[model samples]
Target: MPSIKAALSKPFAKLIAKRIKKWASQPLETQEKVFQNLIKKARKTAFGRDHNFDSIRTYDDFRKNVPIRDYEALRPYVDRVVNGEEDVLWTGKPIYFAKTSGTTSGAKYIPITKESMPTHVNAARNAILMYIYETGNIKFVDGKMIFLQGSPILEEKNGIKLGRLSGIVAHYVPKYLQKNRMPSLETNCIEDWETKVSAIVEETIKEDMTVISGIPSWVQMYFEKLIDKSGKKVGEIFKNFNLFIFGGVNYEPYRAKFENLIGRKVDSIELYPASEGFFAFQDKQDEKGMLLQLNSGIFYEFIEAEHFFEENPERITINDVKVGVNYVMIISTTAGLWAYNIGDTVEFTSLRPYRVIVSGRIKHFISAFGEHVIGKEVEQALREAIANTDITVNEFTVAPQINPSEGLPYHEWFIEFDIEPKDESKLIQKLEASLQKQNSYYFDLIEGKVLKPLVVTKIKKDGFQTYMKSIGKLGGQNKIPRLSNDRKIADTLYKLELTK
Candidate 1:
């Protein structure tokens, strides 16, 4: 059985290697041309045999005719595909569906066609290779690469096993790295989320790891467990790790504590992957955020953040995007999605089409006490305040609560600390002052008595993890909600209050 598995895995791995090399060596122009061709193919497949190909020759024709779509709009089609409607969207069998947690809704299942699998595999491989190339730290002993991700295997219904995104990746990973990579399948597959976390912690201690990849919040939780079990600091356990790649959400608020936990500054990479598509990844280790893979098998569109749903919304092509302008990302992918809005907001850092930064989620804004605050503004204020004072944060969440007696809302900051400042009050004051200065709107709201003053609530070192576990959402792909966009989240926080 082992020999048969090896025989099948080796050839698949070789094919993946060839594809990665080819993609890396291709010129920018060639990549764009390939993307254009793929787009043409996808249009034909998406519209089906009912549409006339001769009528759609120009890019404008495709863009103008195909309506903009969202996950809710695509659910019916996805359901059809899953129910053995193979001839509709997929040319061949779909090996798995990548399940993703919805921001406001519930779980979403995205189909992974055999044809689309290579796009996911290549994007992921190139993301890692890009980091190594840019950092010039490719030389290291053969060690394990740990990916903290969701379980691929879904519960069996009617004796048929369903597979999620993790499963699809698992199926293809052996094709890319036959021997060196280790999937967190065994740990993630456990039925209970908490049990899975415990198992992962136990297994991580036994491995000689070199690369650790996951969402920042969950990774911090795992590190905390290591600290408790080994009686060694985070730096000691990860001292030999060559790289740490993280993504799924912004890590700015937790950056200082994360770096401190690892003992030394290590190379960090961020990725922008979604259930709909593997959208972008950090091309260089030193860069701030990931660059969009413009030439991949995905068509891109940007909706102006200020006027997202206005009739005839202003759309920018890859060549037209500018630096520092917030836009909601929309994508057309090989998975038969057309003009799909993935609900992510991004800003370009450079004029080059590929370089960009994830600013925040489209609807995730803090408006406690009428002070509208976006992710970038909050991150900037936090960074400035931390620079002023020598305090570090590992995990954090900000909630706006209405003071009933005062008839105003105040900002309550829940932060997990690594290093406590000598003057805690001073640190809190600086953070508040910075917010008032940097975010004038918030400042006016507070000063006008529209909102209450900022209050810092220091949490137990592992408070966020405990909260995540309590909600059955503590793992690699799961993330803590930073700015509670909903009132229910605030209610939950109110219930967990350890401070008066």
Candidate 2:
């Protein structure tokens, strides 16, 4: 693998720098104008021949006329493209397919065209650059960068070979820089996903890694393995690392423990990456929230969270979004996805065109008993409660189950610990009090006597890991469901005896 410096010095980095500079200098109004113009052009190019493109001409038209399309809606198109449909979503040739795990449904094979590859690479590069800009350290020439991603090699099934996003990027790594990089293509290019992640764990300990990037859960698991292999603590191995970039899920639950493990406050960058496209990234280095890429090869739309499911859902444009209000995000991407509801909700941290925070997934909530407990609320309560406690939680999952005695519902928290609490009973009480105080609905559920006090289930060190393994899903790209909004998750957890 190539050295970190060489990888960052590629032509792509130069291109990204230019784009960043250009974006940074533009006025908000100018940026909006540019975004609108790009949207117009993309619409024209995408649908000009059939006149179907004109259907989304106006902001209202785009919102009202275009119905929300989910993964299922686009499944036919994705399947057709994979089956050798030449004129697919993008105008350029499709290099390969990005295999993704669809937990709610089944496995999904997404097409990653040549034109869209630059979007992912650029978004990722900008995310890192933003982190450096925030943390005030740029020259990582000597530090190693570890990416906890899927294996870069393709797996064949039923005569079709599928390469994941990680593999695709690995295949296209510039030849000259591949030698010094710690996780070389040979290490990342394993055909079996499990074997690849295991290899990654084995190789990660031998390198002088300075920047770690991956899903928060997998990185944590890797750290556990490192601790086992080296007989050293997380701080020892990660002390040299300057930053941690995590995405794909909320990192709030793991933040305290992660920082504790690293022994210092490591800079973090979050990204909103999807199989269809890279939607947004953390632009400013110190910013906790992500900035939506407004002028990329995509058009954006938002529906007020309160009215997202009204009979006539009113969609708002970028100019209409207000800071601190949650909205259901929609986008028309280069992948030919129109008004696609990517199952995520976001809130603007700043009124400017680019800044926003990923609130949570639309479906990743518990409202079984009219107590709507969202991920953000849970994260907030946990952070507040932990701030006052000596306990450290590495990972956690929350599910709502029926209370047989009352025939109502109650929430059960499954937490994985790095260190046992000094006073377990007090910790649980404090957590419950914090949750009740922070979330009004949860509070009502408890105070109104509809549900009993929240129960905490402390699991073994590798409880989540064991659960993942039980389901034939362990390591890279596989994560324990953070919020079990549906009955299936609760059922699955019950079957595995991971929950009480």
Candidate 3:
């Protein structure tokens, strides 16, 4: 028998499904209205006044008046706001700060005010609810749905509460659905990820867990632990398990490994949520890409990634973007992030429906030899290389070997395999061939002897986990960076292996 909450969820989900469908049909106009509304709402804020928001009547005006800026450029104002200043970026002091990693800098604390909470919370909720509506898979709602979240014990910086975005979100799970949430509150408050995962396995193994949600890598770790403890496959331990909700990293490389871990096929949904806001989600079952959120209090712009590296890049708004171009994303959001470069690059797959594939990070790429290799390209090559083979990559990272002392320059791959491919050497050959097919500059470099083919190094079992633990980054929201232009991380991995 379904609970009252489960019965009502279907109708509410249906409403959201209808709203999103209509929203997708007229994305450009919806985006324009969103931009205008955000501007009006923020016009009195310090940043808005400083940028002359009153003069910004249209998207063109917003673009012409405000230049796109990365985090560093806005740090001064953010710092001021952190020190109890009001209206520095947004209208008032933020209720909380979402702490996240910074690639080059140290940790970053992003302000999350009352005004912006819904953009992160309700928007993501609506995405999941709509998925349930579209698929008519409400059985999971009747059972338990375990969402792997960060530590709930928030730290305070000055007067503001600080914590992981996931942790903060957990505090707001609706009262009706709270009973179905898993991994006891005590377990959720455990700071260490390893200890927390073990506790979760102990608590959830005997429960009726129907759905699980988290990043693919961490979720895989949980599934492995479940199998190890129960001596049963994940599918057996949780027979009712039917759905996987994931985001943060691309699921392509980990798909086979996840299936093998669970021992069966399961429906999965992808989402695009950053510390800044929830951006997109897999709306339909058969869609190749997630639908962009045009009316979610976010105004978006795109700059061609190649041009972004140049002296001057042309910025294109939602109305002007074309399908199939790699563009770095820029956003002005309810969070008071205006003309901000979110550091993500994406490619549009559909125009009318406004669907996009997150290509990669702006800073995570290999261009040591002028052969620009982005995450999308590397992932595509890996997918092609493993096609028709039983190779299941558990985890992997790539870095450039540019030193002449290393003999020849090449891209080095450290792969942790779940299932080894039939032909190891052939895998390398296919990877090289696929890369050449994707990037002509890389092919030219290989032909000219300027760069050698990529080298693959099989990492020892649990090597990535060991490395991540050593660095104190083995936990929720922490990820192994896929590509680096230098040998910093790769050399560390080698040294770790040597010490072992």
In order, the Cα lDDT scores of the candidates are 0.67, 0.69, 0.87
Off by over 4 Å in 1: 1-39, 43-54, 89-93, 103-105, 154-162, 175-178, 183-185, 309-311, 367-372, 420-425, 433-440, 447-449, 498-500
Candidate 1 lDDT score at position 436 = 87
lDDT of 3 by residue, 16-80 (tens): 88888887888877987888888888888889898899888988788778888888888887888
Instruction: Measure candidate 3: CA RMSD.
Output: 1.5
Any idea what lDDT model 2 has? Answer: 0.69
Model 2: per-residue Cα lDDT at residue 41: 52
- Give me candidate 1's TM-score against the actual structure: 0.84
**List of clashing residue pairs for candidate 1:** 13-175, 98-165, 152-167
- Candidate 1 differs from the real structure by a C-alpha RMSD in angstroms, to one decimal, of 4.9
The lDDT leader among the candidates is 3
Q: In candidate 1, what residue range of length 10 has the lowest lDDT sum?
A: 1-10
lDDT of 2 by residue, 304-349 (tens): 8667767878776776778888788887765566677877888888
**Deviation from native of the Cα of residue 265 in model 2, angstroms:** 3.4
User: Who wins the TM-score comparison?
Assistant: 3
Q: Tens-digit lDDT track for model 1 on 213-277? A: 88887777777777788887766875567678887777777777776667777777788777678
